[model samples]
Target: MVDQSHSFYLTSSLQQKLSKLVLAAFCLFTLYFWPQRFELWLIQVVIAVAICSYFSYTIYRLKSYKSSFTLHSRNLFKFANNPNEFECKVLWVSPLLCAFYVLPNTEVEDQAGKSQLIIVWRDMLSDSNFRHLSRLLLYIRRNQASG
Candidate 1:
C-alpha cells in the first residue's frame, strides 16, 4: 500500500497578483481621490463598513469552529484511475459556499485492488468562485503528475 499525503498549494501568477493590486488601487483612487463629493464619501463609508463586517464574520466562524466541516466524494474514482486505490476527504471552512478547501490523505489500498480513489471539493458557491476552484483543481492534477 502506497500512502502518499500532499498539501496542494494554490499559487497565483505574478500577472494575477499585479491585476488584483491594480484593481484595488483603482478602487482606492476612486474613493479617496475626490474630496469634494460628500455623497461619494458617505457611499465609501458604507462600503468600508460592509467589507469590515464580512471579514469579521469570516474570522469569527473560523475561530469558533472546533474543526472544519468535511464532505466526502460518493465515488472516489470518478475523477481518476489507479490500480490500487485510496480514499480522499475534503476539509472545508464553510458548508457549501466558500473558497477555502483542504484535502488530506485518508487510506491507501490494503489487499483490495482498486483503480483510483479521489476526494474532490466541489465549490459550487457561485460562478466566479466555482471557476476559481476549478482552476485550483487543475493545478492539483498537474502537480500530482510531477510529484
Candidate 2:
C-alpha cells in the first residue's frame, strides 16, 4: 500500500476540463503565429528549450523528493477552497498556464494510517522554496501532534 503520510490529492474533473480548453487555445495561437516569422521561430525554439529544461529539472527534483502530488490536483484543491486565492500569487509553468503556488489545503487521509498535507503549485516549487516549505510543514506537523 502507498504511504498514507505521503498521499496527494486528485484534481477535479472540471479543473481538468478547463485545463484542456486552455491548452487548446494556447496550441491554436502557437500554430497560427509560429510559421509567420523566422525570428519568431528562433525565439519560440529558445523558449521551448527553456521550458523543456525547466520541466525536466522540476520533474527530476520532484522525483528526488518522491512527491505524490501533481499540479492539477493542487490547483483543483485550491479552486475548491478559494478560487481567488491564486489570482496574484500563483505562477504558470506550462504553455497551457498550469499554475504553481504555495497554498495550503485540507488534510487528506491516505490508505495508510497517517494524514497528508497538501501544497499546490503549477509544476513544483524551486529548490529553495521546496526546502523552506517542507521545513515549515514539518514544524507544523510536529506541533500538530497528529499524523
What do the candidate models score in CA lDDT, each in turn?
0.39, 0.39
* Residue ranges of candidate 1 with Cα displaced over 4 Å: 4-30, 33-36, 68-147
TM-score of 2: 0.28
TM-score on alpha carbons, each prediction: 0.31, 0.28
Tell me which residue pairs clash in candidate 1.
Answer: 82-115
**Model 2, 1-147: lDDT tens per residue?**
111222243323333444445654565456556667777877776766665565555444443443334222122322333332221123323232233334433343222332223334323444454444343344433433443
Report the C-alpha displacement of residue 134, candidate 1, in angstroms. 20
- Would you give me the overall lDDT of model 1? 0.39
Write candidate 1's Cα lDDT for 1-147 as tens digits. Answer: 122222222222333334445655566566666666867778888876665565555444533322112122221222222243333323332333223223323454353443333222332133454444444444444445555
In model 2, the worst 10-residue window by lDDT is 70-79
